[model samples]
Target: MPNHPQPLRSDYKYLQPITTRWHDNDLYGHVNNVTYYSYFDSAVNTYLIEQGGLDIHDGNVVGFVVSSACDYFASIAFPDRIEIGLRVGKLGNSSVQYELAVFKDGVEEACAAGRFVHVFVDRASNRPVSIPEPLRSALARLQA
Candidate 1:
């Protein structure tokens, strides 16, 4: 498999720092494949809460993951601080595609990169809804 390309820190408008746990590693001594997705989730959600004012608990609109993809270029181990980069790719009426790149501290290259798509839906009805104004504004700032 080919590794994901790394984007420069200046290229991304938002970033979130993540700590890798011991269990995040697989028997092969590198971070497990699944853990990267968790980091992507955290990074994106954190940005939404801080920048988009997303209310995960009581918000009328919620995002559901409809698709995800990742490409690993290097190995990252436990105790490393992973700096996750985020940018908005496609902002649809009810969905947003977030691109993420994970770097092992200070590294200019990404150890892994991928995308996560969230479809906004009404919390009560579970039906698709347009992106709220506040959220849309926040997301637009991160457009790549």
Candidate 2:
């Protein structure tokens, strides 16, 4: 096996709790790979809604995911209470990179680590725009 860099909870600025479903497991009895991306999307967007006050349906500006990648270090199964650690790796004029780590509750090492990039753009025009003040502030708090 290859050595993986495990992430700790202290490394994250925010967290979103998640529950695993039976269907999340595959024949090997662990969560499927695709599910990790779903968790990544949920945790990041939940932060935007709960803390950044972003309106997903009617916002003038929306974030479009342009790039993402994942590295899995461990396995997670159904019935696990997952705690996702989120932090901002970088923020630019109209883009942000979010880093995520998924940990089984009570564990110190991340079961998986991934990143998502969002380009802030005008919803109607689909052109890049400055991140709104509230969104910027919220995102700043997550910066490492």
Candidate 3:
């Protein structure tokens, strides 16, 4: 397997707690690999909506996820309280790369780490657009 660099809790600027659902586990009894991506999406979107003032429903511009990746370091089962640690890995004119980590609550190390890239675009034309001032300022605070 290719070696993926593991991240620590302190590496992130924002953290959001998540409660694992029973359905998140796979037949093997741990969180399904696909669920990690869901956690990443939830955390990033929560930050964008709450901190960046993104109007997902009626905004002229919205962010579309263009790429994502995850690496699991350990297993996490249902009923476990988790926190998604998030930070901006890169901020560009039209795109922002978010790095995230899933950690069991109170744990210092990550159980899984991932990256998601969002490209800002005009909702009507679906064309690329520069990130808005409010969103850009919010993203800058989390830059790593």
In TM-score terms, candidate 3 sits at: 0.97
Who wins the TM-score comparison?
3
Sort the candidates on lDDT, descending order. Answer: 3, 2, 1
Alpha-carbon lDDT of model 1: 0.90
Candidate 1 residues lying further than 4 Å off, grouped into runs, are: none
* Candidate number with the higher lDDT (1 or 3): 3
What does candidate 3's lDDT look like per residue over 34-95, in tens digits? Answer: 99999999998899999999998999999999999988898999999999999999999999
Q: Write the per-residue lDDT of candidate 2 for residues 14-69, one digit (tens) a residue.
A: 98999999999999999999999999999999999999999999999999999998
Alpha carbon lDDT of each predicted model: 0.90, 0.93, 0.94
Candidate 1 vs 3: which has more TM-score: 3
- The TM-score measured for candidate 1 stands at 0.95
- If both were scored by lDDT, which would come out higher, candidate 2 or candidate 3? 3
Quote the positional error of residue 34 for candidate 1 in Å: 0.5
lDDT by residue for model 1 over 1-144, one digit each (tens)? Answer: 664456666667888999999999999998999989999999989989888999999999999999999988889999898899999999999999999988878888788889989999999999999999999999999999
